[model samples]
Target chain A: MSVAQISRNEAQAPVEQREALPLRIVRRLANSRELTLFVLVVALALAMTIVYPHNFPTGPNMRAVLLNLAPVGILVCGMMLLMIAGTFDLSVGSTLALSGVWAGVVSGWWGWPAEAALLIGVVVGAVAGLINGLIVTRIGINALIATLGTLTIYRSLTYVTAGTGVTPISDSFAEYGRAADPVLRIQSPFWAMLVLVLIGGWLIARTRFFRQFYFVGGNPRAAQLSGIRVDRLILIGFVIMGALAGIAGVLGAARLNSAVVNAGVGIELKVITATVLGGASLKGGEGTVLGGILGVLFIALIENAMIINAVGVFWQGLVVGLVLLFAVSLDRFKTAGRA
Target chain B: MGSMLKSTLIALGMTALASAVTAPARAQESSFGPADAKETYYWISNKANLPLFVQYDYVGMKKIAEELGVKATGGRQVAVVGGWDPSLTESVKKCIEQGVPTVVDDGDLPASGRLAYIGTNWTQVGVAQAKKMMEKVPNGGKLAMMSIINAGNMREAVAGFKAYIEANGGGKYNIVSNEDDGGDAQKAAQVTAAILAANPDIAGIAGFDSESGAGIVTALREAGKNPGDIKVTAMEQTPDFFKTAKEGWVDGIVVQNRELFIYYAVKILHDYNHNGLKSAGLAAADGGRPVPDTLDTGVLLVTKDNVDKVTAALGVK
Candidate 1:
């Protein structure tokens, strides 16, 4: 079966025989990766709430957790799109730093209007993405190698552009990130990520043009034979990925009001981890924007729990890695159930 | 043919006389100038990208290089020894054996037989921070500290801070939280916000890492806490720190002599090369102006009262 069909089959349960409710629930969880991640995220959040009632469930703590995960959450939308198209960008972390620095230089150093800085920063990120797309499609370089090369190149450019960093990048520019709704009190980055996830989810699941990425990722050669313009689709996927990374980068810098050169260092791993857990296969064509976002939520909760528990930071990676492996291992049960 | 030979001989004679004439002046130039303009010296550190190293240490090295007429570059250079890893001590020893001049900074590695030790006395920095906190919160309440707790220097500083509080402050101070900010300002801010959430009664915060001060102040502003709501003593003397100090968020800053570390390390290296001290070997104990065992570049306490004066002197603003 094609990779696109693989994800679809999860929803169609076999009418073979009646089973115990517990077994049915287990089978249901195994079948849907989104359900599994959602359940897991809910469970983790509930458990933390129960255990550390005062600390974990408080308004300030929740706000901090939501705000902290915003960047990763925003990046996951683009990553899910790329992974659905059978490729990914490792340069996102560096892209974030580079974009933030440009924004800082424009608004903070050059004394441009905040809107101009925001526009320039996003444009820089899209241009960077455009370069990645051209290189991968035209040069036919592997996405891994192409993006990995750009990762260091972009980071080096960031340092060359602003050695230490641009701090206190105008209060007007900072307001874009710092502004929060009175109801939830969550910052702009979180709100931005939410809007992207909702829109991206609808477009990928419903729209004809976005659905073409599934065909391209599932089987590129077959997709091209069917007049899919596989390379064009993949290139578009990368550009979208880059633009999303740019938005994330700009928001992060604005929120902090400081464009740190090392902002989002090693964040690519976290983002990729969340994408994989969200149900994106390395071979592609098997994930949802919702799944990717749930993965981000799960990891954020895990980190928040660790922080609340006062666990050493060293244990965090171990916990997250083990959880990822455990989540992926659940796929084996789904395969067995299909048999 | 004989006339041509005479002309060559006369040219050779003039060149020889000129070299003889300039030799003493050349020797005198080499003697006075500490380093050769053609030779390049390097300022090496593990985290060269760190703001402390980038903004101050590297600048200091470059300034000294210009003065000494030598080119200086910040490179990976030999092995940089920091952290709590015991293996690093052996690595330093091995590098020392390979005739590499290693200098310890921020933290001491005396067993490694380094040429000289420069930078803040870590333990003293902690004591100074603690003392500053004591000054602000005389009847001390619960205190929280932020740093990279795993680092060797930070551990010493924390221990010293704790020891001083125990010995000096008659049971008034209690360390409620000592968390690691991981040296990233953003992470520091997040951690500080969480810390504030967890410890609503947190009386004061002592920030050991350079990033901690900004993080603490940012967290306070985000939480809508006014200046001096909770006493804060932080490290480093960055421009952000200066701004925060002016706003009265930070009670006192335990400022390390960052530039002085580079200044003294390069001086030690220069003298080691040009002052005929190369033969002094690993310990440099052969007695020809033996390398200073340790140069505690020391710390400066910058409070709101003297922040303007300090910033003016450092030309930070």
Candidate 2:
């Protein structure tokens, strides 16, 4: 080898080796959406804890915040899945109301068993989802149009089925939602959300069957040519989303012991916001369940802090929207830096 | 023979035409004659999905429709149930201009040229709520009021509540926060918890919407507080309110005369349609007759003692 080439190699080797380990770790964290969200969530919690030690970090406040964010967190798992597969459901809020109303009717009015009520609620949600899936997969309608149409239709059905909603929906059924852990004293809804997030994260990150969704979302034509059942996977994704909404609905109704006809109103936007903030893109195939849940946690903390500080309700939405834009913009910088 | 048949047919047609023209005139001659099927008395309202409307307004409309023998149509808009929106005021003005008798419900727009408003006097309702709170906590203490505060009627209610407390509370009652719950039960519960956490010395809570009682009760229960730990007075007589009050989770409720509002509003509009301006002894101005400008539907205060009586009278059981 020539001395000139040798000298060039020696210089390049030194430059590469001189890059510090800490700088590399920082770059890796920046590149990872989930890690960045985790850090932000921890940082926010620590800040609130230090600033409002008496109110923000108290047991009752923590429990309330967790319980309140449970429904949105549960919905995020399904939304993350759909977003990863390049499709989404706008009818989740309506589906939740419909499911909850049915549960109320069965247990409160019809004298059905609590278990049957729960099962029926979930089944109704699944059926609603099946219709959405069939419309999109079989009829070839866009996911947005199909879900938006069903959103109104399902809400109307809920109103038709029970106009004023059912109150005092049986004490036995309410226990399912009211049950809490002894240590944390957090409600069942929060626990349900935690379990779902863990299982969803594992399945999407490690399982080969679920990984096919990433391929389908990335390139549908290529995925189809590769013998993947793109339509079937998308359909399954919707069913799962529907069932999660059902679970959330029943749990919420049980917690309040009332099946409100307007339950879950305008929740679709919040779920989508968290999902996008968690790293899921409209283009799809890029987010994990962990990132999505962390996004929910961060938003929930911000809201809790605002409430603790006695901020006006009008300002909460603006703050959340700005945070979402800022988080998404960070990705652009990270990508540019990588290039 | 054909000409004779044609002449007979023409005579019959002329008789039918004359009868048709005279029928309405004869009907108009009576003070309150039977209503024709085509004369529809529309009750225009907003937020038709509210449980109050579902339970009372629609049911009352059905009864009035059957009695009056006229098609009772309720034109409902899903948006803007409260506050004074220019659009709603304009709509009422246009109705008056078009010679449509419009009576507002739930919230009133006085400048809209509406014939009448058959709903609670929001300020008075607030005063009533304050009285109930005072009764429960006679000495008074720190309090929190929750409602959709941006709404015009709600603002009036809050103002009335504060005024009553200030005037009659002997300076004992203190309201620390007036939180907006967005008229949602779940959001109400969340805000209630936050309020409780922030102000531990809170002695009472006043809810000024239908969804408030359930939310307040749920929040209290979740916080592990017992019945009567914090006095609560809410508006509306919903089934959930009945259940919570019966269980001693709620102290008192100020229920508006909602059914009466619907029942009387429909009857008044029906009477106007049949009787016209002359029968009511009123002059028509701007193509609209002056009827009752504001009808105070009034309210009923329901404690645990009187809840059963009120709910029973309303046929809630």
Best by lDDT: 2
Stretches of candidate 1 exceeding 4 Å from the true structure: A1-20, B1-36, B76-91, B166-172, B277-289, B314-317
**Model 1 CA lDDT for position A134:** 67
- In the range A234-303, model 1's lDDT, one tens digit per residue, is 8888888878888888898898898877787888998999999998999988899999999998888887
Error of 1 at B43 (Å): 2.1
Give me the candidate number with maximum DockQ: 2
Native contacts matched by each model = 0.19, 0.28
DockQ for each of the predicted structures, in order? 0.13, 0.16
lDDT of each: 0.79, 0.79
The TM-score obtained for chain B by all candidates, in the order given, is 0.80, 0.80
Give the DockQ (C-alpha) for candidate 1. 0.13
